[model samples]
Target: MKQLQKLKILDLQDNRIQGLIPNDLCHLQNLGSLALSENELFGQILTCLRNFTFLREIFLDSNKLTSIIPTNLFNLEDILYLNLSSNYLSDYLPPHIGRLKAVIQIDLSVNNFSSNIPSEVGGLQTLADLSLAHNRLQGPVPESFGNLISLQSLDLSYNNLSGVIPKCQKRERTPPQTELLPTLAHGRIAYQELLRATDGFSDSNLLGTRSFGSVYRGTFTDGTILAIKRLDIMTDLACALDYLHHGYSTPLVHCDLKPSNVLLDEDMVAHLCDFGIAKFLGEGESIAHPNTLATLGYIAPESPQERINMREALAALKKIRHQFTQAVKGEKHEDCIALRGESVGSSSEP
Candidate 1:
C-alpha cells in the first residue's frame, strides 16, 4: 500500500483474503474503486474508509462483515454505487442514507438491517435502484419515497415492508451531470412548439423517414434553424448515452437507437432521443419483457437463430464513447473507427 501511491483501482474481490479489512488501505487517498466482495473477510466495514474522498464504489458483499454500517459512509458525495449486501451487518436503517447525493444504486439486501424506510431516501434524486429485500426491516415504507422519480427498479419484497407503494410522479430524466448537461436539458422547445415549427409536421418540411418516425427541418420564431428529428436529442444524446452506459452507478443499455431517434444541431452535432426502451443492466436483470426483436440490428443483426448478445449492446455504447473521445481529441473520423473498433471489440470480450 505504501509503494503504490498512484493505484486507482484495488479490485481484491473473489479471493481468499481474510481477517480484518485493512484500515491502512484507507491511507491510499487516491483509491477510486474498492472492490473487496466475495471474500472470507470479516469485521466491520472500517470507518477509516470514509476518508477516501475519491472513492466512487464500495463493493463488500458476500462476506462475514458484522456490526453497524459506518454512519459517515453516506457523507462521501462522490460515491456512485454501494453494495454491502449478504453480510452479518445489522442495526437500524440510517435516516441520512439520502445524504449520498451522487449515489445511483444501493443494495443493502439480505442482511439484518431493520426499522422503517427513511423518508429522505427520496432526496436521492439521482438514485435509480434500491434493494432492501430479504431483510428483517419492518413497518410501512415512507410516503416521501414518492419523490424519487428517478428510481427505476425497487425491491422491498421478502421483508416486513407493508403498505401501499408510494405514488411518485414522473419527472424529466436527468443523466449524470457532465459538462454536457446544458446541451441536453437547457435548450428545448415545447412539444406544441415543435409541431408549429415543422408547419404541423407536414410532409413538405420532412427531411426523411425513419423506422419509427420522421425527421424534418424547422425554424423557430427567433429564426433559429434546427433539425427537428422525431428523436429526443442530438450529439448530446451520444454524450448522455455514453454517460448512461459507463458513467453511471450501473451499466445501462439504450435498446432503440437509430437515425430517427437522433437529432442534428445547427453545428451538425448528433444527439439521441427517446429512451422508451432503455434497460438497466444490474445484477440478475432480464431482457425478456414485452419488447420486439426489431430494435437490435444497427450494430449486430439477429439472423438464423442468432441472438443478440449483451456484449454487442455494450459494444455499441463503447463505440459511442470512443467516438466522443476521438472527437474531443480532434482525430479524423475515419482513423478513429479502427481505434474504436479495437476498443469496442476488446470490451465486448469476457
Candidate 2:
C-alpha cells in the first residue's frame, strides 16, 4: 500500500471499519471525496486528512469522534460540502472557517460545540446552507452575519443562542453600539392571487400544518395557484406582534412563519399570510420586551432586528422555491401537485 498513489475517491461509509483512519491514507494527493460516516471512528479527523490537498467533499458524521475541529482543515479551498454532525465533538469551532471560501453546505448539528459561533463564519461567501442546531452553543449571535450575502438557509435551533436577529437595513441606534444591524428585507407572497383562485383558503385547499399554523392551497381570480398560510393566532401572538412592529419601516413581521404559514394556490404560487402578530414598526413600541422579539422558530437565527416583513419574507421564500426547484427537477411550479397535505411539523418558537 506504500506505493499506491493518485487515488481520487475512497468511500468506506456505513461500514464496520474501526480504528483510526489509516494515517497513510493521506498519501493520495488526488483524494477528493471521502465518506466515513456512520462508523465507530474516533479521534481528530482533520490531521488524518491533512495531506489530501484536493479534498472537496468529506463526510465524517455519525461517528465517535471527539475534540475540536482542526484549524488546518479549512485550508482546503475547494471543499464544497462537509458534515461533522451527530458526534461527541466539543469545544468552540475553528474561528477562521471562512478560509474555506468554496464550502457551500456544512452541518455541525447535534454536537457538544459550545459558546458563540465565530463572527468570521459570516465571511464564508459561497455558503448557502448552514446548520449548527441541537448543540450547547450559547451567547448572542454575531451581528456580522449580515455579511453572508449568499447564505440562503440557516438553522441554529435547540441551542442557547440569544439576542435579536440582525436586520438588512440599519435603523438609527441609541447607545452602546451606535451601529444598527442590517434590516431584514420583507418576504413577498407572490401567490396571494393564487389564494384567491383557491377560494380563499378553504378546507379543500389545505396543504400542510406545523406547530404554528396551517397552510392551504388556493388560486387567484386570474387562475394563478398559491399557498395560503393560516397561522395559529391563539398561540403565537407575542411573536407575530413583535415582528410586525419592530422589523419594518411600518413593522410587518409574520411572528410565525412555518410550514403551515405557507400555502399553494391553483397556479402553484407560494404565499405567506396570517398577520395575527403583524405589527407596525415605530420607536419605543413594545411587542413584549425591548430586548427580544417573536417566537423561537420560523425567525431566522442570525437576525438581530425585530422586523421580518415583506422584503425579507420574499427573500426567504425565493430561497425555499429555489430549493424546491432543484428537488423536483424543474417542475415549473405545477408538476408536483400531490393531493395529500402533510401535517404541520412542530416549531422551535415559544
Candidate maximizing TM-score: 1
The C-alpha RMSD in Å for every predicted model, in order, reads: 16.7, 21.0
**Tens digits of lDDT, candidate 2, 47-111:** 75666666777899999898888878887766778999998889887776878776889999999
Evaluate all candidate structures by whole-model CA lDDT and list the values in order. Answer: 0.68, 0.62
lDDT of 1 by residue, 1-350 (tens): 77776666788889998999986786787776789999989988888777777677889999999999999887777577899999989989888787887688999998998888878888887788999998988888888888887789999988888888887766755555543323335655677778877899875565443322346667676655466777423434555454444443344566766668665544344545455565555544544234323342232222214345757644554455456556655774443334323343211100
Best by lDDT: 1
Regions of model 2 farther than 4 Å from truth: 1-3, 46-48, 168-350
Evaluated at residue 300, the lDDT of candidate 1 is 27
lDDT computed for candidate 1: 0.68
Which residue pairs clash within candidate 1? 232-273, 233-271, 234-270, 234-271, 235-270, 235-271, 237-272
